[model samples]
Target: MNQKHLLACHERILPYIHRTPVLTSRWINERAGTEVFFKCENFQRGGAYKARGATNAVLQLTDTQKKNGVVTHSSGNFAQALSIAAKNVGAKAFIVMPLTAPKVKKDAVKAYGGNIIECEPTLKAREAMAEKIVREKEATFIHPSNDEQVIMGQGTACMELLEERPGLSAILIPVGGGGLAAGTSLAAYFFGTHCEVWGAEPFSVDDAYRSFKSGKIESNASTETIADGLRTQLGDRSFPIMKKYMKGIIRVEEAEIVETMRFVWERMKIIIEPSSAVALAAVFREKDKFRNKHIGVIISGGNVDLNNLPF
Candidate 1:
């Protein structure tokens, strides 16, 4: 909510999460006609920035609450993040994963010591099962992107980015549930000088973009995007923050997402998932607008299953 709140979150989670590096590529700079700094959250703990929020949430739990543990329904990164964070904080994690979720993600959650609760591949079903577990075990439920503490914690990544590069003209991030976008916008508002914040999302799942324009939450008619991590819609807590601070939302095609993922993997020699590529693809979709500007992109995560490459 404020710089102090974000800084406190950073201080709390600093020892638990990674201060991921910011990297640049001359080729990418020329291609976009902008000096871009990519905050590589892909190299973060649990392979994503989700670790920040999950760890912060876990660490904030009361002693009794920690005894009861925490529960969440996530298809991928957040599941792994909560599992690892809870394990690190000496608490149990109950992860309700959809049956259709990729095997690699499920395996990662298990590796982190999460109790996997398989549910039907629907948001309603996932939430229902998570609630069931919470009721039976008296555990706390943590929404992946909706909790205030989670939002404040997620802002740390952008806080670090802006601290490392104070000259950035703008910051861009992929918007799935709007947590990262909202948090980044807050960081830019509190840290950067004259910096703008933008949200990038896939056209197939442009609910966040439409919600931004309509001033209300919107649900996607289809969930066919290859950005598996972005299939979820924005939450109420993150939506209002995004509306208040975000400059605009940019929608990119599925092909553009795939191409951007390939570009980062082949050109930058770094692995990035489709959801992470959405921000870069949106920048490429509107290169002239950012020409000669110093921009920052949040590479949200890099937990791809190599056997299922989109290319």
Candidate 2:
């Protein structure tokens, strides 16, 4: 979970992953009142920044680990990430995903040689099934966000972005399990212009926001949001890091996320999912805060079925 490790991983992943571009939008800058630049991770391999962490984690696996294989649970993104990463290294990946996971993501996992196990929506249900499958199949457990290696790998995204734009005044990232936020904040501090990093989450699943204010895990009542990629809770490793480095969490409404997604599509010509749009939602909602400043945003996963967009 150190900078050296993250740097080393970037070299390893250079050949395997896409060098997703840092795109600028004049329309976004005018609308958000900030000179905005977006790190288009939605165009990344496996369709999300999760692929960076998943690839680094699997590539560093020991010979014994490769033979034993790995197991993990994801609503979608991380499962497909692990599946493709495991495939590149010739390891078996047992993916326990909810039936509610998007069909595109689930199909990607299958196409990548993943063994899918259906589970209920609850974390308890997913964990129970993943444990059973791991025990039966003798697969190593590759946690979605909690692992230190995964956190370090996730940090590399911010490294790449900050390296490309060192004068960034502030940065925005969508907060799901807080892995990306925590990792990106650390890397921003390392490479950027003393920039403040902010975590953006949909109000539908505003656990990180409440958790930051209340100083404890505050579970949302019921998350009915279009941002399916952002519904997961913060992990033990991620929460402490986010609490230390991140400025604070911004909770955007579901409508804001949808509108931002559509806006980014029409303006930037990028196909991003709702989770990716939360950063834009933050800027759109609080434009004055970002006025006349150099701002950066990480556009996350892009694994959406275009025909099925609720917007």
Candidate 3:
């Protein structure tokens, strides 16, 4: 998509989503040796930035499409987002979720009015189930991260960030299926004065990093990352945008992810998910690069299972 698309998306989804605040921590700045601003999407509607994309995609649907409803396969944030977005517009949402997904997430989806269809905890199964629902229900499919409208909607988070902190030198976002990373990159390119965009990925599931270096889409052989929200692979739509706009991807270890998550909780007193911590861990991993510079970090979500916290 282009700048105009992103701007329109921000306006279209404004009423449906929250303009989450940008927060900062003096201690965090000292620890990283950089001035850091955090765009807390953890505080966003549905407890994640996925709300922006979901709301945008749902709102753009025609009456017939809305009547037919929307269907998507998501294990977490996007499931809740799509359900809530559909409910707000008086539409039905059929969500295909893995049986292995956290109970809390599934509950959230149900609470938001989604009709959950359980599938095997595999991408193939999830996709098959979603496709079947689309055929039988004649529903529209709204991809969590790969759709152009979703990408533009996700960019609005960074657009808001830039509007509040125009002088940011750079922004770091966690890359999963590459929605937020791609969106943030576009936002920085269009809105920032000279802001650079970077991505943080788990070494356990470093498909985005591998894809960036190899100049093609890459798949993960294993999804063994604690940053559950970041286990997905990049799609055709988001990959090209991120490849063209992102500066680079920094991979962090599982331990680093947990440590950063705990650090943010204890120090910033904010409950951020491991996926969100990935971006901050990247900053700590390469502290020298961002030293004395103004950096904006996107906290992607806060839908963590408290009972299973690593720290």
Give each model a TM-score. Answer: 0.99, 0.97, 0.99
Compose the digit string of candidate 1's lDDT tens values, residues 131-173: 8999999999999999998888889999999989999999999
Pairs in clash, predicted candidate 1: none
The CA lDDT at 193 in model 3 is 87
| Residue 208 in model 2: lDDT | 93
Range of the 10 consecutive residues with the lowest summed lDDT in candidate 3 = 224-233
User: What are the RMSDs of all candidates, in order?
Assistant: 0.7, 1.1, 0.7
Number of the predicted model whose lDDT against the real structure is largest? 3
Count clashing pairs, candidate 3: 0
**Clashing residue pairs, backbone N/CA/C < 3 A, model 3:** none
- Sort by lDDT, best first: what order? 3, 1, 2
**What would the per-residue lDDT of candidate 3 be over residues 1-311, giving only the tens digit for each residue?**
77888888898999888899999999899999999999999999899999998998999899999999999999899999999999998999999999989888999999999999999988999999999999999999999999988888899999999999999999999999988988899999999988999999999899998998899999999998888888788999999999999899999999999999999999999999999999999999999999999999999999998888897
Q: Distance (Å) between predicted and true CA of 126, model 3? A: 0.7
